[model samples]
Target chain A: EAGVAQSPRYKIIEKRQSVAFWCNPISGHATLYWYQQILGQGPKLLIQFQNNGVVDDSQLPKDRFSAERLKGVDSTLKIQPAKLEDSAVYLCASSPSDWSEQYFGPGTRLTVT
Target chain B: AQTVTQSQPEMSVQEAETVTLSCTYDTSESNYYLFWYKQPPSRQMILVIRQEAYKQQNATENRFSVNFQKAAKSFSLKISDSQLGDTAMYFCAFVSNNNDMRFGAGTRLTVKP
Candidate 1:
């Protein structure tokens, strides 16, 4: 049973630039999630997917942030014209179902200069 | 809307000692779930323990345990025989039947040897 996987463990980009992060959830997990954690803060839910369908994404900034899980397997989160406030860690997690314990990825730390 | 609160921003416990981290939540749903997650410097969020609202008995895993008070809407984590590996950022989370999860700001715990 492999854990969730994420790419680009560390990224640095100038403010107003675009960036994207990828996530590969654990096999057989039906629920996938994306969260953003700023320094000294807990992870904040950005989006959630249940079998390729968006379950929740109210906190996501629609003007700049977008995510997709088309095949119900891997997913990607993108930020267009990133801002300095976007410098944080992006975490991916997966769970078998609702209310189940989630397995998390190592996360990608993004730094906006 | 659900909210989780961690009153303690930072705490320190000597190795082999015991320490407790306080958490409180506000939710209108009668049935829900609570979780405690540990995020080390490696940037991976690990599930420490979980508790169901309906369950009367507290949840425990190895040296970690939780004291859940439903009436007061409080949930506290207790680490017994604390070890150096327990040092990390601890976050309290909540989720209800709607499957919308919320997290607290987190508490930084340092286990000194």
Candidate 2:
């Protein structure tokens, strides 16, 4: 079976510029998540969606970051006015349900200059 | 808030030998999930193994096994007869049954032949 899919495996942007990342989760999976992994650090959850509705996004930076899972099959994460600290690997993952093992996609590595 | 820790930033082992990666987490929830993920040079996050918090027996998959100490909030991964292909960044993650997942800082493992 095909795993989760993401677009633009790598991206580079200047500080204060805007960047967006896309994710297409596995078929039949009900839970989708976005995470940020800084170099030499573990991933931190940005947002989570169950179908077309958000389940949790408490850790998301409301002032600069936003994400949406509009039809429940695909999702997008956007960061406006990117900063140097925002340079990291953005990962997308999906699971069959709320409490199950997750399947991850090849992350989008964003480098902010 | 749950937090996972990987005290070791890096580790090295000779090919065909064994190596263990340590992890500890802080959480009050009793029913949860723990996972180990491998990220190779390609930047794909692959699930290596997982264990359920309530399960007393440790989880094992092929040459990969976990030593889960629920009371101690410890979960470690043991790779047996390691191979060069096993070299990668390993992350420890926690997911409560409520679906709140958190991850550690990650440990980079190198296998030298």
Candidate 3:
């Protein structure tokens, strides 16, 4: 089976600019996730989706960051007015269900100047 | 809230030798899942091993194994006969029944020839 896929392996933007990242989950997987991993830090959960509906996004920065999983297969994460501290790797993962092990994608490394 | 901690920021081992990475987590929930992921220079997050909190025996995969201590809230990774290909950033993560996954600051491992 194909693993999770992400686009624009690297991205650079100025502070206050806007940026977006895309992800395509594995086929037949019902759960999708977005995580932000800062340099030297582990990946932190940003949002989670079960099909086209959100399961949890309590840790997401709703003020500036938003994500959507349309039709329950592909998803996108956007950050507006980016901050220098936002320079990190954004990872996408998918699982068959809430109880299965997650499969991750090659992350998009975003750098905000 | 759940938090994972990797006290070792970095480690090194000679090829064909063995090394261990330490991790500890804090959580109020009784049931959860713990994971160890590896991120090489390619920046792909690969699941190395996973352990369910209720399980007493450690989980092993080929050259990689985990020491899961439930009462101590600790999980450690032991790499046997380490190879240069093992050089990468290792992260410890946690996921609860609610399906919220949390990660720790990673440990960069270097294998010397």
DockQ values for all predictions? Answer: 0.82, 0.83, 0.74
Q: What is the TM-score of chain A in candidate 1?
A: 0.98
Chain A accuracy as TM-score for every candidate? 0.98, 0.98, 0.98
> Native-contact fraction for each model?
0.84, 0.81, 0.72
Better of 1 and 3 by lDDT: 1
For candidate 1, write residues A23-58 as lDDT tens digits.
999999999999999998888999999999999999
How many clashes in candidate 1?
0
For model 1, the superposed segments whose C-alpha errors exceed 4 Å read none
Point to the candidate with the largest TM-score: 1
Per-residue alpha-carbon lDDT of candidate 1 for residues B49-69, written as tens digits (9 for 90 to 100): 999999999999999999999
Give the best candidate by DockQ.
Answer: 2
Q: For residues A1-113, what per-residue lDDT tens digits would candidate 3 score against the true structure?
A: 88999998999999999999999999999999999988777888899999999999998999999999899899999999899999999999999887567899999999999
Worst 10 residues of 1 chain A by lDDT: A94-103
Ranking of all predicted structures according to TM-score, beginning with the best and ending with the worst: 1, 2, 3
Tens digits of per-residue lDDT for model 2, B1-113: 78899999999999999999999999989899999999998989899999998899999999999999998999999999999999999999999877577888889999999
Error (Å) of candidate 1 at residue A31 is 1.1
